[model samples]
Target: MSTTTLLRSRPSRPLKGGGVSRTSPLKPRRSRLLTGMMLLYLVYTLVPLLWLLLSATKTQDDLLSSPGLWFGKTFALFSNIQDTLTYDDGIFLRWLGNTLLYVVVGAGGATLLATAAGYGLAKYKFAGRRAVFAVLLGAVAVPGTALAVPTFLMFSNLGLTNTVWAIIIPSLVSPFGLYLMWVYASDAIPHDLLEAARIDGAGEIRIFFTVALRLLVPGVVTVLLFAVVATWNNYFLPLIMLSKPNLYPLTVGLTQWSNQATGVGARPIYNLVITGSLLTIVPLVIAFLFLQRFWQSGLSAGSVKQ
Candidate 1:
C-alpha cells in the first residue's frame, strides 16, 4: 500500500512500444455519455406515460390542477376504474371485448397468411416473383390511412358496412409484415435444409410447417406483435366503417367518452376517459413484456446473421 510499492506495481511500459494507451480515458467518458443519454431518453418517453397513469387515478378537477406526477390525497384509482367499467351500461367492456376479437382474429390471420406468402417468396423463384415483391414493397410505403375511404366504399357496396369484417379485412393485408417475414425467412432458413428434407421425402408443406416453423417463431412473434397492436389501435378505419356502438373498439369508445366530456350538460367524463385509456394500454404492456425475450432473440438473430 505504500507509494513506492504502488509505483512498482504499475505497468513496466506502454502496451504498444511506448505509445500511450487512450482506451481507459475514452471508455469512461463514452460510457458516461451513453448512460446519460439513455437516462434522458427513458425520461422523455416515460414521462407522458406516467402522467397519463397519474392523471387516471385523480378526479377531473384534480387532473387539471394537481402536479402531474403526484397523486391526489383521496385515492380514487378504484373509483375511477369503476366509473370506466360502468359507464354507459358497461359499454367499455363490450368495446374491450370487440378490440380483443379484432386483434386476435385479424392479427392471427394476417400473421399466418403473411408468413406463408413471405416464405414462398423467399424460397421459390417463380415467374413474376420480382414484380409481386415490388408491388408489396410499394404497398409497404403506402400509408394504410390512405385506403380507409376506399375500403369503406368497397365494404359498403358488398353490404359489409357496420360489420367487423370491414376492419378485419383491412387488418389482414399488412405489407410490412410480409416484407419482414420475407427478409427473416430468406436470411434465417437455409436452402440446403430444404433439399435435405426433400431427399427425406418431406412434402413442401410438411417441411415448412415442421422444419422452418420452429426456426421462424421469433419472426412470427414480431409479426403478431405488430399486427395485434395495429389492429387494437385502429381508430380511423373503424370510425368510417362501423357506426354501431356495439361493434366499436376500445379506441372508438374512448373517443366517444372524450367527446362526451366536452359536452356542456353531461358531467365531464375526462376522468373516465383517462382511466379508460390507462386500462386500455395494460393488455399491450402485458403482451410486450411477455414477448420481450422472443423479440430480443429475433432482433439479435437478424443482426448476427447479417
Candidate 2:
C-alpha cells in the first residue's frame, strides 16, 4: 500500500462518549414550554376578537343576556349595522367620513413628511443633524398623552380647537415613524446608488421619487400603516379638541356612544355601539392584510447585514 493511500484511509477519531451525536435534519428540536406559551398567547389575543364578533351579532337585550364568547339566539348583525348607520341622521357615517379624512390626510401626510425627513437626515450631512436626531429621540420617548394638555391649550389659543385641523395637524407628527424611516433608509438605500443617480444628472427630487421611493416601498408601507392605526385610534386628542359630534372620529364617536349608555338619560344603544366597533376595525384589518407582505419586509430590513 502506498503511504498516500494509507494516509487517506486513516480512521477518524471519535468524540467524547465514543461517538458524535447528531440530530435528525428533518425533525428539528423544539421546546414544549415555548410552544405552550405561544399557544396561550394566541388564545389571549384571539379571545377578545372572538367575543367582539359574537357580541356584535346580538340585539341590545340579547347582548346583555348572551354569553360573551357565544352567539345569541337572534342574529341581529345586519339589523345592528343598519341601526348604527341610520341612528341620529346617520351620524355614524359622518364619523366614518371624518375618520377617513383624518387617516387619508393626517396619516398619509405624516408618512410623506416622515419619509422625506428621515431620508434627508440619513443621506445629508448638515449642521445640527445630531441635535435634530437627539430631539427626535426625545420626542419619541415622550408619550402623546403627556403633550395632549399643552396641545389643547395651543390649539385653543389659535382658534383651531373643535376643527379637523386639531386632530389632523397633531396626527401628522409621528416621531416613531420618522425614526423607523431614518433607520430603514440608512440601510435600505445604498449611498452609491444615490450618487450614481446624481451622476446621471437626476435632480434630488427626481432621484427621491424615482430611486429612493421605489427602494422605500416596504418602509413607506410600514410607516403608513403605523400612522393610519395611530390616527384612527387617537382618542384623547380628539376627545379634548373637538366639542362637535360632527368632527368626531370613530374612536371618539364610539366612546360617546358607550358613554351615552351610562348617563342619566341612558340611551342604551349597546347593539349599535358593538356593531360599530366591529365595523371600525374591519378597514384596519383589511389594510394590514393587504400590506402585510411589505410590512413584514420592512420589519426584517435591518435584521441581516449586507
Taken over the whole model, the C-alpha lDDT of each candidate is 0.86, 0.87
lDDT of 2 by residue, 172-250 (tens): 9888889889988999899999999999999999999999999888789999999999988988999999999999999
| Cα-based lDDT at residue 24, candidate 1 | 54
TM-score of candidate 2 on Cα atoms, chains taken together: 0.87
Q: Which candidate gets the maximum lDDT versus the true structure?
A: 2
Backbone N/Cα/C clashes per model: 0, 0
Clashes in model 1: which pairs?
A: none
Model 2 worst lDDT window (10 residues) = 7-16
lDDT of each residue in 1-306, candidate 1, tens digit only: 344333333324223423444555522225787898999999999999999988888988788778889997667899999988998999999999999999989999999999999899999999999999788778877877787788788889999999889888888877889989999999989999999999999999999999988889989999999998899889998999989999999999899878875657766788898899999999899998888666766766666553
Residue 112 of model 1 has an lDDT of 95
lDDT score, residue 237, model 1? 89
Q: Count residue pairs with overlapping backbones in model 2.
A: 0
